[model samples]
Target chain A: MSQLKRVQQWATFARVWHIYDAAWQNPFQSAELLKKYLMGMHKPIYHPMNDCGDHVIVINTADVALPGDEWKKRVYFHHTGYPGGASWTLAWELHKKNPTMVMKKAVYNSMDRSLQRRYTMERLHLYPDANVPLNLLENVSNQIKQLRPKPKRLDEYKEEEVREFPKLIDLPKSYIVE
Target chain B: MVFTSVVNYVRARGPDEIWRKRRIFKLAAHFIGRRRNCYSIALRNVHRALAYATKGRKLKRADMANLWETRVRAGCEQHNISYETFREGLARTDILLNRKTLADLACWEPYSFKALTDIAKRRALDDGLAGIKADTSIDRIITRGTLHRDK
Candidate 1:
């Protein structure tokens, strides 16, 4: 018998995956990607009751970008039982306080609202930068691509590159070139 | 009003002897016993049947809801979480799943349901500020202090 057939009979449930280098990527698309693996929806053998999900290692979340003014407009609300204990936190404020929280929340809300969702959430490990520890890093057997193109930082451009690029319009003398 | 040389019971109804052919008896047509043909008995039977049906409709709904709750409770027990805690936690967190779906998840899809219980358990603990003590205990790992080299 083939090894593939043998493995098929056992129903190997999950595998860990790494999603790195998503700097300045859209959180919405990232959330959508995470949902597929978290729910095992991408698997051929996925069942509603089964926990055959893929564990996701999300690193470099500090540079995640939200389209439009969502950073200021999006509000997260939580309330305590007391008379007036409700608290609202803006996206940018949350990002400033904890860089990984935005991604964590995105992934958390994407899953089905059940106790199983918590377990799936546990599988999603978030790191603010590329420096994920050695142990968790080893568990990652696969690497997933980013949802959107990474934004090129200003520093990434070559010193002489500006001269070669096309100019759409003649700049005014007062508009000093950077 | 003028009274014509009126045609009252002088002519026979022929094959359609329908003195009892009002809407009430028509509703009772499918009923059994003397109620099938006898007007008075049919009227009473129809009234009783319709009344019972109206009441039973409400009761049937309640009964189904109760059954779903019972299943959900059983599922909770199977998953080692109390039904009340599960419900309260989900409700407080605004998870907002109805009992029918919860019950279905519990019975046919145990793992999916177990996930819901986990969320409930977390919410219950987080419900600390709400001054509500959690009724169930779920295992949680809070920190990863050090990284180890794997073999």
Candidate 2:
């Protein structure tokens, strides 16, 4: 069998390095946000020169539910270097057509565009289907799960508990309707 | 430091003594979970540490695609067609352009995007003959059975 077929057909991908647990729920940081999340500056092992990270494989991109209007508002753009060479697309369309590529591209772009970035990217494998070949993940089944915390109800916090933001003072007279 | 202490404790007790007791790790985790200040933070940190150690790679493609679609929708709106209508028109017209490629063209080549949109618009305008609504969303089309059934 072909290597691609073998990899695809395996019930699990063993020693697959790392796979994102479906249970993990958190908004991903932008380029700047990643620094804090990884504790880049604070870690003892911090080195400006090295990619001190492990391999990660993401599965189930189609079902990666987001919290709010992020899915509706976020815009992705690519330039092909021509007059009017700016193509943009919404996220929902890409997810429907190609789930794996959507995620792989995001992670790749989020990382520093360097040789180390390419190296880390090599470790990432994206599969759109929920039933990822079991062999790749066979040894790590105990560690993988989908355990998102139930979203806390805002009503439970009540009106007083919510922090009030500073009032806006520069309201445009034309924009104000009666 | 904690790892060394745990290792020393196991060594002092003998390997078999530690191996026989499976709940030791769980007990340690539970103890850590109960601490009011530093220990509770340490427990959560340790849990995340373990997760990062074991969790799989995630590229966050869904987020990326959403970002792309938003860009596309904004561009489509500039052309006076809502993204919902544009997508519906494309589906009805049987246009093979995927959003990624469409977004790519829309960003790089406005003329080409305009041409493609023209095709969709023409198809949408011809909806009476095609028997599909030109100005609707994919959900409505699917739900209303306007999508071509393979009967």
Candidate 3:
């Protein structure tokens, strides 16, 4: 009877895949919503020690759009240890080369940096093309809630990020006067 | 009775305002002096606090600049340009841009930043007339040493 109840609970919580026709203007924001829609944060067994969640299948990564000129302006950097050896790639180029990477990066950034992060990431199914046939959103929607609004940027935070270099490039007073 | 006692005590004092000021100053002096029993120590502590606050402000400013430089360098690398190479290209092209401004521009207006890089590319291509490889634009130089492995 207990085993039967477990199966019944799984069936009740199970999601039917659904896709909204709305444009993915903010892929990160959409991903955050879909994370809940896919039941990525819950388990039927109610185990805190165990990672329990459902897989999320994301489609139309290539069609994901954004407002403003975020692609060309956002930069990602990497380095090689030589005196003059570092390389960079623009968000626009990355979008062209691998569209799914943009959303993946956003999702990765949004995830909590705990042991569960990797487990959660593994359940995220991202596809560049919009051809997935799973429509399990009904069961998923019940457990999901809209994300809390982020606080507005304050001037103090912006002022804190400003970097000012020393005008004097000469050696310190502790060094020899010569 | 308490009010009368207080009035009486105040009346016992002199009419001069200087004495009141002196009394306040003396109270402050005593309060501070009581903490360490030396006026020099109190003065030194105040000076030290000011010095620490000044140093802390300076450190915060420097740290912010370092963050900006790091972000710009990272942004430049994404554009296939090193912070140094990008600066060199900007200087060579006579573009008077600072790292902070460049970083903000890069984040807020990427297309314009790319145009700047393209200008550098055009200059590099034109200057490589002696078979120095015109295709080695700032981007190429920046990407030449990039690691392909995932971070």
Q: Pick the candidate with the highest lDDT.
A: 1
lDDT of 2 by residue, B1-151 (tens): 2465676766675556445343344434444433323444545665665676454234346545654575566456446565766777778767777777777776666667766665565556545434334543322223122334323
Q: Candidate 2, residues A124-147: lDDT per residue as tens digits?
A: 556665577777666333232234
What CAPRI grade goes to candidate 3? incorrect
Give i-RMS (Å) per prediction. Answer: 11.2, 16.6, 17.2
DockQ computed for model 1 against the true two-chain complex using alpha carbons: 0.02
Q: Model 1, range A1-178, lDDT digits (tens) per residue?
A: 7999688556555464755555788877789877776776554344557667787888889989989999999988879979899999999999999999988888787766887888888878888999998988887877777766676676788867866678899879889766
The runs of at least 3 residues in candidate 1 whose Cα sits more than 4 Å from the true structure, single-residue gaps closed, are: A1-4, A9-11, A163-178, B1-151
Residue B137 displacement in candidate 3 (angstroms)? 66
Find the number of clashing residue pairs for candidate 3: 13
Best of the candidates, TM-score = 1
lDDT (Cα, tens digit) per residue for candidate 1, span B6-100: 45544644446464456767898788889977888888888899999999999989977876776787676655567888898788768899988
lDDT of 3 by residue, B1-151 (tens): 2465786877776767666455444434534444334444555565566688889998988876765675565455556544565666567667898767876776566667777766655544444323223444444433211323212
Estimated TM-score for each candidate: 0.50, 0.33, 0.35
RMSD of 2: 26.1
Number of residue pairs clashing in candidate 1, backbone atoms closer than 3 angstroms, sequence gap of 3 or more or interchain = 8
Ranking by TM-score: 1, 3, 2
